[model samples]
Target: MGSNYLLSPYSLKGLQLKNRIVMAPMCQYSVMEKDGKPNDWHHVHYVSRAVGGTGLIIMEMTDVEPDGRITDYDLGLWSDEHIPAFARIIDGVHRYGAKIGIQIAHAGRKAEDAPEPVAPSAIPFPGPEYKLPRALTTDEVREMVRKFADAARRAVQAGVDTIELHGAHGYLIHQFHSPLTNRREDAYGQDLARFGVEVIEAVKAQLPPDMPLFFRISAVEYADGGYGIDHAIQLCKAYQAAGVDAFHVSSGGEGPAGERKPGNYPGYQVPFARSIRQALNVPVVAVGMLEDPALAESVVGNGDAELVAIARGLLRDPYWATHAAYALRSEEKHVPQQYERAYH
Candidate 1:
């Protein structure tokens, strides 16, 4: 395929991206104090990537509630006061010609270091050291859904280009979706897909029609009796029917981390995205240790996925997409105009 194949722009809903490469949301744990708010570190960090050349930069897994934080320092958008901090970051990202997206989430059973973790059931995450989560009441679950929608509304007010529901890596939404964690016999637990579908529908209902909605899903649980790709495909179909704009395909994290493939290799989890993309006509983003630009290009060129999101690769070097542009022979692809002087 032509080198331009990797350089070509893509669209999700009405949001147009500069290229097929995206900066996958990775928790930085850099929030200001225990207040759960974004700070200059977040602004400089994300803006630097936008300035470097990333087509889209998804801000870290922002907590939707105070107790939902994975760590005390996680960013949050659950209140109106948090809007201005993110607004600054969003403005800076736009200045560099990159679109910004936020990964709104509730950690549930995965709420690390919190006084109490919450989930659909009282099941402890399958690790000895992990805390057992208290089961949320039916009303509490409904309130969490509203929290997600409220966060989406706050994101819009902050001028974020898109909103990605954090449904992956065994967080709150993932806990409800996986049979291994959601043991309740109620509407959410008895119907494995009901919880996630409800959250997506609720969030979508609160957002503007033109705003793109992205769902990050852990395609497999990587443990015996855990949910797998089949369930993921079903979830994708449900989200598509509910007007979701894209799927961020990811895997592992329900059980022991040791159960997953140890090393990060080129395009290791591309198959998950490939499978989901084929199952649904909606765009799919392939993430997970995709370090090589050529390999990422091949993923898109081969139609395995529409977008390739680089996490640690971009963290290691913010100029990843710029270098990828050179490797792909599309030197001007995503570089900011001001950087053109340095390049030449």
Candidate 2:
């Protein structure tokens, strides 16, 4: 028997996870009907990870509105009718002893398929293929907050163990917080985290008191003169006050990298996660190229972060958690009964 922190159990408020291994929410873009609902593809895609022994599975960026999606194929919780589809996936994940969460977001200017995308400012996403976005009116901004709360309400009905507000990766919440994107002169402009805080508070009202809420944040922007760790820490403090239980620390999705380029090596973002985890005194999930089993194990074992989110690694191998347990010589064998022969 060998000790492996990555395979150890973790608890956050009402959510109890079997291990520290998190299946990062990666968009599948497989919504065949373009109706903002999960189908067979999403069901299998997420459940297989649970069956493979992931501790937690955060579903991809599910939007609050139809036009909030990056593309029509993305998932959304705009209507009650969409609840059943997500419920099916969540139930399946639970059956395999994995907890599930949904990342609710709005694409804003990143809504590639919207006829007219909306943003905090009328800025394009620095790509020729992207369309210029119109700024949201003050009333529209308030309404957007309500939309986020509504989505959270529906997610609870669909039976998620927790909820994650996608405030990273140049999405709507990211745009509102980033100086590079939010040129608004309104209150949202003066207080960069105002939009995110509002959304957090609103979403909190819809969640169970014991259920923890996670905020996925870009620890630092890569654009020239963009906000760095100090700014991210301040944002996290405000979000923490507003009810964010933890943060998933990632970086450099606000725009293309500037003079300070993003790291392409493994565990490059772990330092940022560690910084935030220390500064805020909250648990964080370290992501970005942390696929190597040894590296993933180190992040948790070293106390850099409470969890390690695997993106492409889990994609390449559904049994990543099980395989990692074996590789690390963990005493707990995570393989399923049917797959016991293969593991042995």
Worst 10-residue lDDT window for candidate 1 reads 257-266
**Tens digits of per-residue lDDT for model 1, 1-344:** 33865678988777998898899999989876888889988988999998888889999999889989999899988899999999999999999899999999998988887788999999887666579889999999989889998998899899989999998888998988887888897888877778788889988987778888999999887776667689889978977787688999998777775444423666778888898888887788999877688888888899988888999999999889888888878745666677778877
Task: Candidate 2: give the clashing pairs.
Answer: none
Which 10-residue window in model 2 sums to the lowest lDDT?
331-340
lDDT of 1 at 333: 63
Model 2 clash tally, residue pairs: 0
lDDT of 2 by residue, 172-218 (tens): 99999999999999999999999999999999999999999999999
| Maximum-TM-score candidate | 2
Q: Distance (Å) between predicted and true CA of 341, model 1?
A: 3.7
Model 1 stretches with alpha carbons more than 4 Å out? 257-264
Q: What CA root-mean-square deviation does each model show from the true structure?
A: 1.7, 0.7
Global Cα lDDT for candidate 2:
0.94
